[model samples]
Target: KALQFQEAKEKRQKTLAALDTMMKGKDEEAIKKLLEQKQQEEAELQERLGEASQKKQAELMSLREQKEEVMRRIHVVEAILIILCVAFSCSKRRLECNSDKNFDRASSLFTSTN
Candidate 1:
């Protein structure tokens, strides 16, 4: 009976050791899988960042073009206003010249008739 008890105890120790080794192997596999998933997530995040940056750059370029167009329009309007001012000044000078000539001709005719 003593010998049987010793053999059973040895068998139980061996079984426990095997179970512990299997659990350790499973833990290592789980850790490796988790690391791989984290790396994949990082890669995807980088790709998304690149896409967003490109989109923003395009939007900035479009805004710059619109700004340039608005500036050109402002310059055109300024040129038109300057032309209108010059035309108005010239017309006023011509009218004053015509009035002076008429007054001089009327005085000469009155002196000649007297």
Candidate 2:
């Protein structure tokens, strides 16, 4: 009877060890699956962020181009206005010089006649 009890105890110990090994394997598998899922989610999130950044960059570029075009048009208008002002000033000075020459000629003629 003593020998039989000893054998039974050994068999029970072996079964318990096998159950422990199976549980450990399942835990490792669960951990691996969780890590894979997390990595996939991270990749998807990064892809979305990249797409959004690209769209924002394109919008910024378009706005910058529009601003440059507007500035160019403004400069053209300013140049035209400056040209007109210069022309007006030159014409006014020419008229004044002509009037002075006419007055001097008239005075000389009158003095000579007297």
Candidate 3:
């Protein structure tokens, strides 16, 4: 009976050792899965960052083009305004010269009548 008890005790110790090894393997697998998940999340974040960068660059280019277009329009308006000012100045000078000639003719006619 003592030998049987000794054999049973040895078997229990062997079983406990096997269980410990299995638990360690399971722990390693869990750690590996967590690492893979973390890597996947990081890759997704990188992809999103790249997309956002591209979108912002496109928006910046579009805004630059719009600004250039607006500047061109402003330059065109300024040229038109300059041309109109020059035309109006010439017309005013012509009107002043004609008025002076009419006044001289009237003065001569009045002296002859007197």
lDDT of 2: 0.75
Of the two candidates 2 and 3, the one with more favorable TM-score, higher being better, is: 3
Per-residue CA lDDT of model 2 for 68-87, tens digit only, reads 87776665555555545545
In candidate 1, which residue pairs clash? none
Which residue pairs does candidate 3 place in steric collision?
A: none
Between 1 and 3, whose lDDT is larger? 3
The TM-score leader among the candidates is 3
Error of 3 at 114 (Å): 66
Worst 10 residues of 3 by lDDT: 105-114
After superposition, candidate 3 runs with Cα above 4 Å error: 94-114
For every model in order, what is the number of clashing pairs? 0, 0, 0
lDDT of each: 0.74, 0.75, 0.75
Could you tell which candidate, 1 or 2, scores higher by lDDT?
A: 2
